[model samples]
Target: MLDIKFIMENSEIVKAACKNKNEQDNVDKIIDLNRMRKIYTAERDELRRQLNEISAEIGEIAKKGGDISSIKVKAKEISEQVKSVEEELSIVEKELDRLVLTVPNIPDSSVPVGFSEDDNKTIRIIGEPQKFDFVPKNHIQLNEKLHLFELERAAKITGSFFPLFTGKGAKLVRSLVNFMLDIHTADGKYYEIFPPFLVNRDSMLGTAQLPKLEEDMYRVEQEDYFLIPTGEVPMTNLYRGEKLSEDDLPIYYCGYSACFRREAGSYGKDTKGLMRLHQFDKVELVKIVHPDNSYDELEGLLHDAEKILDLLGIHYRVRVLCTGDLTFASAKTYDIEIWAPGTEKWLEVSSVSNLTDFQARRMNTRFRSSKDNKLHYVHTLNGSGVAIPRLIISLLETYQNSDGAIEIPEILQDYFGAEKIE
Candidate 1:
């Protein structure tokens, strides 16, 4: 949520930023609402003061055993007026809040100017796509040959887009979860946690997953919980409604959770197998840091995610998300896309974003500086240390040997309990 005071003071600047993001529809409305609310607040406050004075006069009249009927009549009229103003004020505030919620976060100055993903500027490519001697099979096909995923049975049990990992596939899923968490814990100095897979509405809103994108989420009909779309929702809300001292400037944690998504309208796109599924596992990295160091820390978090692809020797590149392509809460985002030899395209395995206090403002997570007692919103950042299904897809495609085996990345062999999957 935006600070209404800031918006009131700098409506012009806010409008320009919103216009640049192609969000002009709500700008003028919000600006006007803010103005009206300002005027109404002044009127209401003045009336409240007058009512208090009348109450004091009435008390004095009673104490002196004098006629208080006139003062009582005036007080009754003022009280009725107050009720009317309060009614209008409530409506104005409601509309104002709705408009504010529609406004996207201001883009970082360093972010490149452009509207679409096509306008996104590339950073650099990490490695070359591998070449295969045989007509390479995609992860889905390989899984079929190796008895890894049982799609037919899964379809019968659950609807389409649900696949059951069995034998080698189940092991691969387990290995990826552990492998990603281990790397984040050791290199990133992050605490590891396993958060609940279900979260309340307020928790979802804190992570920017509610109020706007409700259709994309799965909510439990009878409970205060919605199946968490990602681990970030629960992890970021850990410090919700809490205050931290200056000594707790930077807080980092990596969490693993099974994610659920409705995928309401997605069809004819990545529905073949593990590429697009109803349920998947992910290791998420979330950070709460001081405003001054958030960008630097966000970059570090991005690279920490990249290290998994780095250690696996997978080819990938980072792309800065444009305003149109950015998430609602992110001030800036860098998506790390790994090369999938099977599909001959880059599939995003991670997206690191710096929310720059937008999320903290909503969650009430703040830090106090030693210099002054004033509290300020701490910056929030989150990224997929790496998503499992896509990495699994890339791994099966990139590391497959001619003999129809997968050469385990050296770093993961110890965890896999074997050098290769044959």
Candidate 2:
């Protein structure tokens, strides 16, 4: 949520952001509603003031044993007028609030102005794509001989696009989760949290997922709860509606969760094995930091996410998302795509974003400065330390031997326990 004052002052910039993000422009409506709200509020306040004076006059007349009925009637009329203005004010405020939520966050100055992912700027590419003497098989083709996962059975058990990892596949998923948690929590750089997978509407709204992406989420209609789309949702909402001390700035948290999404708008896209799923596992990283260092924290956050791929010895590249490709709540975002030799494509495995104060404002999360004793919205950032499905796809394809065996990376060997899945 942007400050109404800021929107009023910077309507043009906000409008541009809406255009860039491909969101509907509601700045004009919001401005008009806010103006009406101010007018009604002032009218209500002035009427109440006049009513108070009339009541005082009535009291004096009563004390003097004089007629007070006329003054009392005037006071009643003013009181009724106050109620009318209050109702108008409430209506305006409600509409203003709804429109405000529809407005996308302003893109940071550094973000490139582009209309699609093709226009994204590549920051750097790390490592070289693995070379294979034998023709590499895609994850699905390898799965046939290796018997890692059963997509047909998974579809039967729980609709399409849901994975049912069997035997070594199951172990690999668990090993990856544990490995990521260990890396992120090592040296206490990030606090590990295991949060609830189901969240309420406010939790969704706090993370800026409700108004825009609600259709893509799984909802428990009876309880009005939503299945979390990522660990970032639950992890970031931990401090919702709370104030923290400045000393607690730069709070880091990492957690693994099973994310669910309906992919409502993603129909007709690649639904190949592990390409897209209704449910997936991911280790998410979130940070709450002082505004001054938020961008710097974003860099560190991206590095932390990249560290996972680096340790796994995967070839990946980082691309800074253009404004049009940015998420609703993110001021800036960097997507990490891993090269999948079998798929002959780069798959996005993580997105590190600096949301600035966009989410903090919605969550009403603020920190008190030690120097000034003033509360200010803290900037929020989140990233996929890495999502499992695509990573698994790349791993199986990249490390596959000619004999159809998968050699686990050295760092993950202990966790995976003799991981040559033959």
State, as a TM-score between 0 and 1, how close model 1 is to the true structure: 0.93
Question: Which regions in candidate 1 have their CA more than 4 angstroms from the true location?
Answer: 54-71
Question: What C-alpha lDDT do the candidate models reach, one value each?
Answer: 0.86, 0.94
lDDT of 2 by residue, 90-140 (tens): 988888999999988899999999999998999999999999898999989
Give per-model TM-scores.
0.93, 0.96
Q: Largest lDDT belongs to which candidate?
A: 2
Residue 146, candidate 1: Cα error in Å is 1.0
- In model 2, the clashing pairs are none
Judged by whole-model lDDT over C-alpha atoms, candidate 2 comes out at: 0.94
